[model samples]
Target: MSDHHIIDAKKMMITLEDVNKWYGQFHVLKNINLRVKPGERIVLCGPSGSGKSTTIRCINHLEEHQQGRIVVDGTELNDDLRNIERVRTEVGMVFQHFNLFPHLTVLQNCTLAPCWVRKMPKKEAEELAMHYLKRVRIAEHAHKFPGQLSGGQQQRVAIARSLCMKPKIMLFDEPTSALDPEMVKEVLDTMIGLAEEGMTMLCVTHEMGFARTVADRVILWIAGKSSKKRHRWSSSPHRNQQGPGSFYLR
Candidate 1:
């Protein structure tokens, strides 16, 4: 954990107790449990089909579990629409595909959620959007369409778009999986900047360097369950572990 990071054991921001899920009899997640404190960064890494992505999706209620409890920022994930909306609003998510509106300009894409969901004024939303865009060093491309930007630039815009919501917890699901190798660093850099500011984040990526540098805790998932949890950067077993076909991020 970074010395500057704030983690309150008493103030839990996210909790998953005895969580279990299935895909029509195919057990995807079993007895999974987790807890996340505010301002703490966690890297969830494992090979494909390890249920890493499903776990985060459950946090936002994007993928519902068949059993167990999930609570975010003190709000329990249940059938209530109000609670679901609150969780979604408080937790921002960035995906591997850079899910941006094709016809919308970068500025418009960032401002859309705030204007529609938060009901902010157009000018105010645009201002907030530009603030984050500049933070990610993409203000110059704010007027461009998603197709016009490189993969890295698009992913940064996705990050900026998520930040515009002012979320309490940010969830990244394989954020760099789709980018070119050369372009991956830019997106990782933007995330690193967010980490330095003490943003509470849970990232699902194979970027072990990012994990080592910014992660307060690293969770490894295997066979639908959390296999291990490591505390402290120097203690990460993955630091000396890397190779193709060895179950590292691929």
Candidate 2:
């Protein structure tokens, strides 16, 4: 990486220009464009069909684009499966659903990816797994199965699992949306700790509090499009939403 990459460090690991997508005749994304930098923190929010999740999903090729370009960590996502795989290994994602394996112990969940994807030594992978589990404040529950843990604990495990991949960037799609009201804070706190440590994150969430604390900017997804243009909330944003809708990163 050159100084251009360094100075432009916030330049964009994921970039989309004039991107469009559709599901059958239903057009989902409309000329979507987004740019995420090396360690910048961004929050994406809006009404349900606003296409917040679709935007990030496009970065990893989870949702195929009908038109436009997506560049992840310098690699352009395309028809090549190999390219998509490379991008995924460099980018980690934590979803709304905890998505933990019910039959697997928490420790196993954390270790499986590093061992298989990174080809890390079993002992080393286990050590790294333990390290991240501790970071998520769940090392004590490592041997317990997902069914045995609370929703909050499972989300912690999910975070640990993603970190074990050692991704250069992290994507969070409404990570705390599925948690119980009280359990939301724990996971958000864990994310806060990571943000404080300078992890680049693109989060789709209604956690205005979390966004206010750490976001460099806020990106809104209109209908199904996430614009390349972004608005900087130099200071903290204020919340003014009434009950029916949710406010994020305020």
Candidate 3:
């Protein structure tokens, strides 16, 4: 519980300052810095291996940064297990693949985390899970196994599962990449609805159409670093002057 503020911690939901990471001898992230305000939707886009996924991964301490600071909801990340757990409780993540339990039904999968991690009662967790499932339009399939659902439906379930935690910030690491072409839109539509509701999100994706529709800012990650050029669509009247794909440099 480090109270030391890096950048008006009261106003920013997430802050990463001079963050750096390495895998063995290879430097995976270089001096990464970012600040996200509550309710802001940010898109991180770039080619493969550009550190887009790594950045969001570090936020929740899934992949710890070897250097610099990461603060989420005023909790600075460190070796302190309590601080890490606190941040994880406030941030929910949706991955590229739908990592659901094959043995559990959709409702069960969604309720497990809340029951175990959040110490919620089983009945209460199930109620919360169903609330989010309906929000994602997948409540009717709540009793189905993950394998029984379509890719889009499962991904929507994944999103709902994350929402069950009642997180203040959501991180999406190319959530639609593993979906079929026809399924991508359904997942994106669910995400768009989340954006409209003012959920604070940081997403990594190449879907320019989704970015154009919901992103308050688009950041380009290149070669382990975020590009200097950023597109701030919310305040820029010329945001649409160029095509969606033209917003970020390749």
Which whole-number lDDT from 0 to 100 does residue 69 have in model 3? 87
Candidate 1 per-residue C-alpha lDDT over 116-155 given as tens digits, one digit per residue, 9 for 90 to 100 = 9999999999999999999999999999999999999999
Q: Output the number of the TM-score-best candidate.
A: 3
| lDDT scores of the candidates, listed in order | 0.87, 0.82, 0.89
Angstrom error of the Cα, residue 197, model 2: value is: 1.1
Q: So what's the TM-score on candidate 3?
A: 0.91
Q: Which digits, one per residue and each the tens of the lDDT, describe model 2 over residues 1-250?
A: 3556444423577777678988898788887756676787888888998878887898878889889878787787899889989999999899999889899999899889888888999899999999999999989998999999989889889989999999988999999988999999999999989887989898999997787777766776768865455344433344222111222222
lDDT of 3 by residue, 64-168 (tens): 999998889989999999999999999999999999999999999999999999999999999999999999999999999999999999999999999999999
Lowest summed lDDT over 10 consecutive residues: which window, candidate 1? 241-250
**Judged by lDDT, which candidate is best?**
3
What residue pairs are clashing in model 2?
208-248, 208-249
Question: Distance (Å) between predicted and true CA of 208, model 2?
Answer: 0.5
- Return the TM-score for candidate 2, rounded to 2 decimals: 0.87
TM-score of each: 0.89, 0.87, 0.91
Better of 1 and 2 by lDDT: 1
List the candidate 1 regions with Cα displacement exceeding 4 Å. Answer: 1-10, 229-250
Clashes (candidate 3): 0
